[model samples]
Target: MQYNQRTDFRSREYNGRLNMGVDMRQPQPQAGSVHNDGINRQPMPPRAPKKKMGKWSRTLFATLFVVGFSVFLAFFVLESATDLFGLNKEDKQLEIVIPEGINTFQLTGILKQNGIIKQPVTFQLYAWYRSLSMPNKKYRAGTYVVNTNYSYDEIIYKLKSGSTKDETVNITFYEGMTVKEIANLLEKNNVCDADDFLEVIDKGEFNYEFMQMLTKNELRFRRLEGYIFPNTHTFYIGENPTSVAKKFLTDFDKKITDELLERMKNINMTLDETLTLASIIQKECSSVEEMKKVSSVFHNRLASGSSLPKLQSDVTINYVEDNIKPFLKVNNQKMYDAYNTYVCEGLPAGPISNPGIEAIKAALYPENTNYMYFLTDKNGKYYYAQTFAQHQKNLAAAAKAGAGVHGTTTQQ
Candidate 1:
C-alpha cells in the first residue's frame, strides 16, 4: 500500500550473490564475506554529485546582478536619462496629426512613430496609468507641434488637454436680419447649427425668468428680432454661442435711444406703428437719403386728414406674415385681402423685419415734403406729385420713358 518501499536485502553484495530474481529457498552469503564493512562494493550507485556551488560562480553572479539592477534603477529613477539612453531624437519636435477614430493602442504607436515616446509599451503603460486616474481622457483630434523640451509628463498633459485656440475671425450681422437670416449667417461661419439656432429664436414662448430679462421699454411689443443691435463682433476662446445671441438682444435695447422713443410719442404713433414704419424704411432704403425720403412719405401721409390717410404700401403685405415665412409674391387681385393696400385702410399688423439704427433714426426724423403721391421712374428715381391726377401724369411720364427706352408702350 505504501508508494515507497526499501529493498528487503541488507546490501547490494548480498543481492548480487543471488543473481536473478531468487526464490525463497536461495542460499545466503557466509559470515566472513570479502566485504570489509557492511557496505556494497559494487560502487554505491554514484551518490549524486554534491550540489555545492563553485567559488567563482557565486561571486560572479552576485556581481553581475548588482550591476544590472543598479542600471535598471538608474534609468527608472533618473528622469532625464530616459531620453538620454532611449531610441528617440534628442532635439526633434513631435509633429503628430491624429486622424479620427483610432483606439488608444493605435494612438500609442503614433506617439512612438513621431518619437514622442521611444517605446510603445512604455507609452501604453503610462497611458493606462493615466486611464486609471481618468477613465475618460478625450482629446480632440488635431495637428500639434509639440516641443521635445517638455518632459513625458508634460507632453502627455498637453495632448490630453487639447488646448488649441482657434484664431478668431470677426463676423458682423446687421440688426434687422430675420432669425432665419441669422441662422444662415451662423451656418456659413461653421459655428453651431442653422436649424437648431432657428429653433432657439422661434422659442419665443418664454418662461417667467426670461420674460423678466426684458426692460419695460423693450416689452412694449412682442419678440426680440429687430431689437438685437448689429455690429462687428470678434469671437475667440470662452465665447459661448448661446450667450452671444442673448448679448446681441441686450445690445439692441440699448440702441433704442430715449430721443427716438420721445419722438414717436410726440407724433402720436404707437411704438408698434413706429417700429413697423422703421422696418419698412429698413427694407426700402439702401442709403440714408432714400431712408429719410421713404420715412417722410409715410409720416406725411399718416398726418394727412384725407380719407386715404393710410400709408398703403406693397411691403405691408410682405410684412403681414412677420417675415418668418418667405416673402410673398401675389397678384394684386389675389392680394386684395385686408393685407392689400388697395383694399385695406392702414398699416400692417407688425414689423416686416428687424430695423437697424439708421432706419429707426430715419423714421424718427423724416424729411419735410408735400408729395402725397410718388412713383418709381424707369430708372428707379422718385417722381412725386400732390394729387391723384398728378400721380397719373408721373406714371404716364414713366410709361413714355419706358416706351422711349424700349420702343414699346406699357399696358397696365
Candidate 2:
C-alpha cells in the first residue's frame, strides 16, 4: 500500500505538529525492524493508541448531546410531547370558544383539556406573570382564534387576553334579582367570586377592568336595584369583573331602550313612570290578559282627576320581596314599608322590580276600558269594577270563587 493519503484517522504527525489533509513530519520505521521505535521496535509504541479520542472530545460531544436532549425534554414538559409544531401546522387558525365568567382555575383546566395549552401550570404561571407586568390588567371576553404551533411561553403571550371571537357563554343578571341571589348563582359553578362577587353587585365597588370601558354617560347603578336586566346574553369566558358588569348593563339598556322607553312616549309616559307602572302591572296581573286590563284601569284612574293620588299601586311591597305566606303571619304594619300603596302615595321611590317586555308594553299601551277596580278570577283573570262597591263585590266573589289562594300578599 502507498505510505500515506488523506483519511479521518490521521490528524497529527510524530513531529508534535498537526496536519489538515497534508502531513508535516512523521517518524519512519527502520527497514526490516518491527521494534525500531520501542524496546523491540514494536511499531513505535502503537502510535499512542490514536490518542483514544481523549475525555475532552467525549465531554464536548456529551454536552452537545445533553443540550439536544434537553431541548426535546422541554417540549415534553410543556405538553407530553404531543408535537406542538404539528398542532400548529394542522390548523393555522383554531377557534377556542370559552364562555364568559369562567374562573382562572376552571379556565386553566379547560385549556389543557382542549389541547390549546400544553401545560396547565405553565399557562397559569405565564398568565399571572403577564398580568402583573401588563399596564392594564384582566382579560377581556369575546370570541378568539388561536394558533397552536407556539411553545408554552409563546402560547401564553398570544392568549393573554383570553377572549375569543365566538359567542357561547352568556353572563346575565335580571334587574329584580337580589345581589345575594345573583352572586350565589354566579358562583354556583365557579363562574364568579362568591363573596367578592356580592361586593361587586351590592357594594357597588368598581371592578378595575370594567371601569376602563364604561361609556361616558352610562350610569353605574349604585344600588344595583333594577339595574341588571333579566335576559339571556352571550359572554366570553375569563372576562374581568368590569366587562361582565358592563355587558349586563349594556344588554339591559338595550332591551329597555328598544321596547320599554321608545314606546313610553307613545303612551304619554316617562321611562321611570312607565317602569313603575310596569312593575305594578307585573305584580298584579295574574294572566297576560289581566295585565293589559289592569294596566288600563290604572291609567283610567289616573285620568279621572277624581282620584288625585295618580292610581296608588302596592307592588313595591313585594319589590323587596318577602314570602308573606297566607298562613305565615307577620305583623301587617312592618310589611307596610314604602311599597305599601296604603301607606305611600304614587309610585314607590322607584320601580318596584324590573319588569319584563309584556309588563313594559302593558304600561305603555293598556287595554281600552272604563273600569276602575280589578279583582282576580279563579284562574287569575281580572274582574274589573267601575265602582268601589262593585270592586268589593268582585273581591268577595273572587275570594269565594277560589278556596282562598294558598299564598298571598303580592306576586304575579
* Candidate with best lDDT: 1
Stretches of candidate 2 exceeding 4 Å from the true structure? 1-180, 194-224, 235-239, 258-262, 266-268, 304-314, 321-336, 405-412
TM-scores, each model vs. reference: 0.48, 0.47
lDDT of 2 by residue, 277-330 (tens): 776777666567667888887788667664634454544555444422231245
Kindly give the stretch of ten consecutive residues in candidate 2 with the minimal lDDT sum.
213-222
TM-score of 1: 0.48
lDDT of 1 by residue, 12-63 (tens): 6567757865665736555444455575444335568787889899999999
Best by TM-score: 1
